[model samples]
Target chain A: MSESDRQGGEPEPEPERTSTGEYVLGGLGGLLVLLLLGFLIYQAAVVRDTGPELSVTVTGVETAGNGWSVHYRIANTGGQTAVQVQVTGVLSRDGTEVEESSATVDYVPPGSRRSGALLFSEDPGSGDLQVRPSGYSLP
Target chain B: MSATTDTEHLATGVGRAVGGALLFALPLFMTMEVWRLGHTVERYRLALLVLATVVLVIGLAHYFGAGPGGVSRAGYLADAGVALVVALLTASVVLVVLAVIDPVQDRQSALSVVVIEILPAAIGASYARSQLGAGSRRPQAPRYGHEVFLMAAGAVVFAANIAPTEEVVLLAAKLGERNAAVLVVLSLVLMHGFVYWVGFGGQEEATGFLRSFRNLTVVGYVAAFAVSAFLLWTFGRFDGVGLPVVVGQTVVLALPASVGAAAARLIL
Candidate 1:
């Protein structure tokens, strides 16, 4: 290192040119920041939530073995995140509860969805199969 | 020949930047809570964080050039821009490799994940390319305000690394009021020692033991504490907690953050 440099003195003169490419890159970078900030503000303004509003829907039913598997999706529409979400699926025949199963999702963030499946000995298609989120804890 | 040399020099700078980003962000990348926080953190706060990071990078790039460019207003802006790009790219690649985000299916989540990791990586990138690259230019001595800002930046880097974990909350709950007070005093003493006594690079001139202590050490600790509280709040650690718990958690995180502040003055 030069003595001047060692003493934290003035740096040795060197070319300090600002190339066209650097200008363009800087413009692009500034643009990216603006766009990202705009999107985030828009999202914040538009999306309103009181708490975690969770709902479950049956996406599909498939035969995995002697019985059938009920594929379900849990969606949280609220603003807050829910943890240890318990999604329960019930297959009832003639208003009598026949088979029931529940799945636990570790997390379901707001405006996000998680998928799981519940299996039963009876085909859910034959019975009135209902899938709904049973309960959840605040994250 | 000159143009070719410039291209080669930029390539080397870029290479070191990638190395720095990965090296600094590795802990965060592997952290499970951070992965979750990527998607769970409030959108507005995330946006503010990105803005803060941009401003910080520009400040850092002022001191440390991103490449061989001499210090100029436009040059530093461009350098800051390049560092931001390097940070984003590094974050995207690493998050994908770790399977933390599925960009194809989850664009918003992926963006959030990338944004959360960008700050530290950008700092590392700027620091590496400027200090580690060949033909490195020595940075100008920072003013007092910038020195404090650097301490806050360092505190953020260190505190963010550990804030997402459950341990902060758990430890705070168990620390009790007495131990918490002890920890606070210990943190202050350590910070004072590191600021003056420890033979770290860029050590501030000890005008007097009490003077430097009052100025840098006390101020730095306050900055670290504020930074710690902000980070914990951003991570939602203060969501449903009581005041005592919040204070304890802030104190817990402030310990490392204070050390980080001290170390930042020394190293950065």
Candidate 2:
């Protein structure tokens, strides 16, 4: 070993930069901000159709709380926003409305689809289920 | 620059930041679009918005008051970060309690939703000193450009609360072409009146009515429209919508935006 290694004054240790509290707080804050940003970047992108057309498509019939329920999806095909959207499902037999059930979707934005369940006293699958958009108000 | 992490500094400042978040950002929390934004906002875009908000919050802290005096850059950034965290936490808690964020809400989307909210939510945190302190308003005649910027900021805040939902589009749809035209004129007149006639905050400083209209009111309205239009585009209000619809929505949004601009001149 060199003679300097044996000497006590070989090197001086640097002063400790305090602010450990700030370091800890800043570290914690940075971690949270990054984590939040990471989650935002990782999430899936939601792409809805563009426009103001409201179209109702019946997807399935399910047994709900009562006799039966018609499950349907409402899509806004037009280019504007429709508010207070009301959908009607009419069970028809020989051109007569056997059972009518109506469901409401509070809002339906253009290119977005929302679903609702229309409960009917009669079996939804038993008759020709005709679902139609009843009414909607412009936002 | 809230550069110092002293115990007292943390306590009082944090409490005030929380209060600011609640007072200023509550409307955003209740807005349907903001809640729905959790589901609809693109992930990457939300990240960008959050990042931008971070920079903006830091700038606000630097300009307004990050620390008691002479805050460094680190302090400004750190203070903004803390304020953002507080705002985000507050929003999440309130939303969860309100059932706006249900168990079924996608965690990623919920995070994104809450993150995008930081845009306006962070305002309360960074502006707490000016908003809450008694007799502390130091209103000065801002430069013309700064005046326009304040209007834009106010407009953006108001627009953020309105544009995300389907209300603007719905309103556009409901209004007949003639009705929409009338609304446009009405908006312009109101914007002019708010500053010139109403004598709110900044309006009191204007010269004559015509000159004020030309120099301040007219300029302010145009800036509000421009800001509102930009917000409308960002909010997808123009997606698949025609020019007429766009104009209608713009008018609807501009009214609030102009009011915000006037308020900025008065308040900020």
Candidate 3:
């Protein structure tokens, strides 16, 4: 039989050989890539589960006679439950600090939200009312 | 030419493809996490849905035309481009339809917007890295390595961007527009640049000096965070100063972590 017929048609071309450097480098690179992926996945887990550290969202604020009444919706956005959540409301007029009032809540649970009020007497002229969530100032 | 050669070639190809896919998945997951954390669930859900759709379309393309030879550079780019265009068009149509139907601002819509805005960018960046090193010899090829490097870089960026501690402090300080902008830009550039340099430096250099330098960077970052916190605290004492400590801490951690990762990538 002819060589071509014996080989069953034309012989396939030889595949390109990969170099040693390429193989070694590629393998190392692949391993590093895997390690990086593992690290990232771990990082993502950390970011996701790291419970409510401290986060406060202001819902509304208003003014009442004789003093300024401020309403705040506070939540312990961190993972751990906070014992005391203190929120301080500083009334400012024309970029100047006029009066400040604060209120403290007993316990704030992670993922749970609550509202509180703080009143300041000294009139903060016409300006924006600013509320700050201070750390858990214990009793 | 020979059966053995064909088998070896096929094996290497499969290995690289699997490695690439896994590498790709890492950033995608992290990106999802960032979206989930930075925004509401509805937003995250919407983004994920869109992303899934994009992936499906790409999958379909591969199933039919590409046929598992592993996506070529052009094929990957084309798929990504088409997916992006479809996503944008779908989003615009949805927005218009919603607007016409009396404004759907439910969790879904909000989430959709956030997802549309974020995921595309993340996916696009990932695709770019993949295409850059499509057929290299290395098992981990520069492209895939770069992708991992980018993900690590991204983690740092995400951490820095949402740095609650710095944000809270800056806001409390009542930093003027210029100062605020400057602070953000500087932090991002310096921190990200540090990371990129370390990453690009390669493993050996990264391990030698960069590893030891990391402690110094961390210490410096902590000190910087403390100083920022102190400034906020003192300013608060005077009035008109409300510090956001959480934001500041986030920023501090992101920079160092990003830089450290880059350094590790470069040297070790």
Considering every candidate listed, which one attains the maximal TM-score? Answer: 1
Instruction: List ranges where model 2 is wrong by over 4 Å.
Output: A1-31, A42-139, B1-5, B103-105, B132-141, B176-185, B201-204, B207-216
Q: For residues B1-268, what per-residue lDDT tens digits would candidate 2 score against the true structure?
A: 2455455555666688778778778888888776655544455557666776676566565555453331556655666666777777788888788877653423544565677666677777667733433212232334566566556666666666676667778887888888867876776677667666786655555577688777777788788888778767755568787898888888888878777767766656
* TM-score, one value per model: 0.88, 0.63, 0.26
By the DockQ metric, which is better: model 1 or model 3? Answer: 1
Collision pairs in model 1:
none
Which scores higher on DockQ, 1 or 2?
Answer: 1
What tens digits encode model 1's per-residue C-alpha lDDT throughout B108-218?
677788888887898888777667433355455557888888888888788878888889999999999999999989999998888677766665668888888888989
Model 3 docking tier (incorrect/acceptable/medium/high)? incorrect
Residue-level lDDT of model 1, residues A1-139, one tens digit each, is: 3466566675554564655555665567777877888998888789775788999888899999797888888887777778899988988999999999988998877767888899888878887988888998875
Q: Supply candidate 3's per-residue lDDT for B255.
A: 47
Model 2 residue A97 CA deviation (Å) reads 26
DockQ of 1: 0.45
Q: What are the Cα lDDT values of the candidates?
A: 0.81, 0.67, 0.42
A21-62 per-residue lDDT for model 2 (tens digits): 433554565678888777555542443324357889988887
User: Candidate 1: deviation at residue B226, Å?
Assistant: 1.6
